[model samples]
Target: MEIEVVVPGGATIGEAPTWVAAEAALYWIDIKRPALYRLDPATGAQRSWPMPSDIGAFALTADPPGAVVALRTGLFRLDFASDKLDRLAPPPFDPKLFRFNEGACDINGRFWIGVMFDPLTEASPPLKSSMHSFTLAGGLRPEPDAAELHNGMAWSADNEIFYLSHSQRQAIFAYEFDPAAGRLGAPRLFASVPKDDGLPDGAAIDDLGGYWCALHGGGRLRRYKPSGAVDCDIALPVSQPTMCAFGGADLEDLYVTSASDQLMPEQRRREPLAGALLKLRPGVSGLARSYLVR
Candidate 1:
């Protein structure tokens, strides 16, 4: 399916584009610039929230219910109706060790927020990160292992497995998941992508159980089946395709978000379209909307 660049917002580092079905809108975050954006595909109306720090990623929560955001420090639930934010978990016990990264919600509607070594410090260099998960009732739980640059969070259609990408290694890993217990098993390689384009950053699952991944450096979006096979590739004009999701009324439209934070001066000039939101009508459709746990 062909993808098109729609919202030319020119985000510095756009990641985690998610569809809020009930609102008929797409939500995403610009990490480096630290902003939250809400976009209406139908009307092209965009609203934004200025954040104090770079927001790693976010998901909808249940319980007292709101949007859960992964900040560089810790996890917080945002009361959208009241425009308030409350910390759910303190930053990693070892503040110097890790910071929040990319993540998404599980099929059960619980928010999963991962972490990586802090990139701002000399010891916490890029790509040296780890992944984690958070549940409203259970709190935060660390994954067995982590990555240098963790990203591209997702879950399978059946919710039996979870998928995440390591930008530093240029690999996507699939973990056997237990939805009822909210546990992850040993991870198996889902895909091995080339580093020249970029590592996988964010992803989404389709009804077919295949994963659509954003190649952060690859300047493209790729589809991989549960068997770890490449299904198709949708190349983009930009270099840093950070994340993507299936949106629109029918869930057949593919929306991609990109970034320009790491581009050199000359490269940035050449790829001015980097960091814009793009869209396309892929023939394949997505699954039913997964509401944010309230």
Candidate 2:
């Protein structure tokens, strides 16, 4: 399938891409640029907002005027209009060694976020990351099992299955999910990406039970069967397709985000579209995003 550039405005590290049905716009973050954007898909009208600190992840909240965001400092609620931030939770770990990364809202209206190792200089020591969940009533709490590079996150349509990926581990894990309570059981290895397939960064689940993942360094997107088999693979022009989400009117259009942060000068020159917002029709609709209940 062919993918066209949706919003040509280049991003440094385009990470989380999500659809807003009411606004008819796509929202995503450029981690390297350390900013947020709202793109009108049909009109190509783009609006960018700079963040006060390094923003790792964000999700549209149940409240129309705000969004829950994970920043290097901690979790905060941003008023999109006023650009004011209300600190909801402080960083659980020391900011010197860790920073927030991937995040998504669960079926129960809770936001699940993950953190990654961030060293000041080049270090060869083994590093690990952690995950957490947040709700206005419950506050922020940790998730079980520290990860090497916590990345992909998704829940099944039936709300009984959960998917998580650790980039350094090169494997995606599956767990029994309790949607009513937003809890996860013991996990088992569901599938592992081959060396040639690239590391998994972010992912989403379709209504048909297919898991769509962006291959960070391999420049591809893959749809995996619920049984842990590779069902479909689509190539992209960029070498580092970071994350993807299902958007558009019917949620059948797949939107992909890429990265140019790790690209060398030559690679950047070769792949001019490295950090672009891409779109395609995957022929399968996706489940609507779960709102973060205040």
Off by over 4 Å in 2: none
Residue 80 lDDT, candidate 1, scale 0-100: 69
TM-score of each: 0.90, 0.96
How does residue 101 of candidate 1 score in lDDT? Answer: 71
Whole-model lDDT, model 2: 0.85
lDDT of 1 at 66: 57
Candidate 1 C-alpha error for residue 25, in Å? 0.7
- Please give, for residues 1-294, the per-residue lDDT of candidate 2 as tens digits: 888998663688898997888888899998867888889988889887788777888877656577888888888888878888889899987777788888888877788888788755676575776689888889998888587578888988888888999888899999898887888898999899987889988998899899999999999999999998999899898889988889888998999999888678898888999888999988999988774554
Instruction: Using lDDT, give the best candidate's number.
Output: 2
lDDT of each: 0.76, 0.85
Residue 17 in model 2: lDDT: 92
Q: Model 1 segments beyond 4 Å from truth?
A: 61-65, 93-97, 124-130, 289-294
Model 2 worst lDDT window (10 residues): 118-127
